[model samples]
Target: MSTNLNQRLFNAADSLRSKMDASEYKNYLLGLVFYKYLSDQLLQTVVEQAGELLKEYNSLEKQEKLYRDFLEDESTKADLIQTLKDVINYDIEPDYLFHHLAKQAKQGTFQLNDLHKGFIYLTTNFEQFEGLFDDIDLTSRKLGQDDQQRNITITEVIKQLDEIDVLSHDGDVVGDAYEYLISEFASSAGKKAGEFYTPKMVSKMMARIVTLGEEDRKIFSVYDAAMGSGSLMLNVKDYIKDTRNIKYHGQELNTTTYNLARMNLILHGVDNENMNLNNGDTLNKDWPTDEPYLFDSVLMNPPYSAKWSSDDSFMEDSRFMRYGRLAPKSKADFAFLLHGFYHLKDTGTMAIVLPHGILFRGGAEGAIRQKLLEDGSIYAVIGMPSNLFFGTSIPTTVVILKKNRTDRDVLFIDASNDFEKERNQNKLTEKHLDKIIEAYTDRDFKDKYSYLASFDEIKENDFNLNIPRYVDTFEEEEPVDMAQVGAEIKEIREEQKQLQKELYDTISELTYSKEDEDWIKGALEVFKYED
Candidate 1:
């Protein structure tokens, strides 16, 4: 049933592809779906509260009418809304409900202004929801050349979303469905997707690795400095037993994506207070510079090789000061890693995705790598396959860093080849992820797949943490049998001799001029056996 609903939701997005690029159209489609989710939650809560409110209405139309009737009563309207606010900490008026707007759209009475007001009400009334709907441009000419056409387009989308029973299923299912839509948009967004989303398989892998042995904790905090869509942080929740006790901290440079991360967390039913999301550049500035700044786990997939203002000012910042040298301005991979690591608790685990260059790059990066290794802060380096990301095809490595690790050896897993090919992208399946998790948790060395490289071995190699230097994935070629080759060559030669003699006999049977026949026979002489 969830699969069917997900398809219908994606189809709605598909309907708008002719209007704009997936990068742009996704804002409208996802916005409405999110809006519908909020409205449905309110309506569902109302039904659950009133008990008799929706029980008689077998059809959505009747239920919506019933809701409209209930709201029309002036005596009960305020009391009902207050009750909803008390329960969910928010309320949507019946006039602005998703079903009502969808009904308006279905009847050709929908106004783009009405939807605009709904967005306005939420943003104006709530601080958390402020600027949330700013990305969904109802005024865009791309929706259509004019107002009525745009209304028709948005109307069609709302009506399509109306079919989704967002309240009939579990909140987690709805949230997962929302995630499905985000992923679909990400796939369509191509290179642009890196700005907002990470492939779920990778997120799951990092989540499992970071949450290992720490699953039973009553209160766990996870932070992502470059949190794209907040999926990585949410994955940490998936692996924890007490998900509700988890607090999420994230900062994104893109406002649109930050809004997406907010909606994602909210839909996942993360309490508003539990989400600490900021829309700003994580490198140029720092966030959560207050109480509870540190986290138990820091999971990140920052933009690879992205340029940052690595000014001398940042050297004074606590995050980068310890390294003595800064990550190169041209590649902020180490810079992001250092920031996330700084926010990690002494007992916390941090897993980050960076370009393979960080493993061996020289100069500033080399200096920083040496410091981390010397301090035994670097935990494990796992090399993942190329094209597993959305935009770039360069192979990436997940560098796991832990604070206060007594072990001096770093585990290296060469998982670069263990992925299922999915058309244009490489996917890490459950089996592939399980193998990596087993290897990571066991910390056991498997030849050609993983290795436990000691500090001495790393220093011997000039502190280069490249996987090839430690975990050798090279396959030795099978030994050749010279006698078998010689026998095959002899058999081929014997067959060739018989075939040549038969060819000469067949050529002798054909009629030709003497001069021409002699020329052909001369060419055939080159094919005769040596004997």
Candidate 2:
């Protein structure tokens, strides 16, 4: 069933591929999908609750009675909507439901103003629905230069999505299909894709690392400073031993992607009560909170080398104060790292994906690196292959951090060679992921693959934690056999000489005109095989 929806949704999305950029069309598709889900949820809720009240009547008549009774009294209608608001956090009238709109569209009776009114109703009353539909502008000429064409195009898209049954109880098909669409959009979105989606494979490995050996405690909290469509936070839940209850806290800068993240959590069945996803700058003005060092695990894949305000004022900030110097203004890599680190619990684990420059850069970044290493907060660094990301081909590294860590040795993993090359990007297969994770878990010292560098050894290199410096992945050239190669060359020359002599003899016996035979013999003589 999931496979069917995945194919259908992707095909539906392609209908608008030529009209607009994928990054733009993605919002329209995802927003409408969310609307359909919420509408179906409301329909199912009303039917179940109303059916119980009319259980005394027969089946067909009971259905009619349920609808009539709910609508007959204005007070009952208000009470029911209030009850729905309490349960689902929002209310959707039957007339404004997706089915109602989709049916009208199919019958050629749908009005663009009708769709506009439904969106207005939701956005006006629910803060969560704000700006989510801004990208799907009915008045945008991109949909069509004329209002009629725009209506037809949008109507067809809605009718297509209305075929999928999002109300089924068969697993999390809705979330899985949404992920498929997001992945497709990311593939075509180029550099902008990284801002909204981290490849699932990378997120899964980081999730496993953070939740590796933890027991099923009563409460577990996960944070991604740059949440990116909530893929990373949702993925961490998959690796936990017991996820009866988990809290997701994240801040994202982009508004459209932020809305996508919220929708993703809701469709994955995460209640609004359990999540605190924010749409704001994580670095400039972090969501204010009194609880620092409260998260059990922190994960981040912020834009590499993004610029930030580097005033000396940040020196007083709790996240950057301990690092001695702020991360360079031009490169906020360490700033994001430190922010997540500060919010981490003493027993928490943190993993971040950053460019390789953070390992050996000089000046301000270097000083911060030295201080972190000396504090023994650095746990392990795994070097990954180049071109693993969507847009960039530069190799990246995953640096894991642990607070109050007992070990003073830094584990260096050279997994840069362990990847399968796809068309445009390198990918970590399950086998590759397993090998890297095993090495990380055991802290094994495999020759040329991993090394445990003592704190003193790292200090000797001025606190440089480059993979090649600690774990030499370079292989020595095999000793060459000069005599063997010389003998083979000699044998080949002798064989060529014999073959040339045979050709000369054969040509001497051939019939030809006198001038042609002379030219043939001359040509044969010039083909001498030098020994």
* Model 1 clashing residue pairs (backbone): none
Query: Against the true structure, candidate 1 has what lDDT?
Result: 0.84
**Residue 498 C-alpha lDDT in model 2:** 93
lDDT of 1 by residue, 422-452 (tens): 7667889999999999999889889899999
Total clashing residue pairs per candidate?
0, 0
Q: List TM-scores for all candidates, in order.
A: 0.88, 0.83
Residue 502, candidate 1: how far off, in angstroms? 11
Off by over 4 Å in 1: 1-6, 52-59, 167-188, 482-531
Could you say which candidate leads in lDDT?
1
State how far residue 337 of model 2 sits from its true place (Å).
0.8
Summarize candidate 2's per-residue lDDT along 1-531 as a digit string, tens digits.
676677667777876777888777767877787888888776556666665643454342243345446867897888778777876778766567787788888899877878888889888998777776776788888888898988887888888888877766354543455456645666665654555566767888898899877647667889988987787878877776666578889889988778888888887767766788888988886553756436999988989889999889888887788778999889999999989888889989999999999999999999999989988999999998887766667888999999887777999999899989875567889998899899998897998999999998998999998889999878899999999999999999889889888777787677888779779878767764454
Worst 10 residues of 2 by lDDT: 54-63
Question: What are the per-model C-alpha RMSD values against the true structure?
Answer: 3.7, 4.9
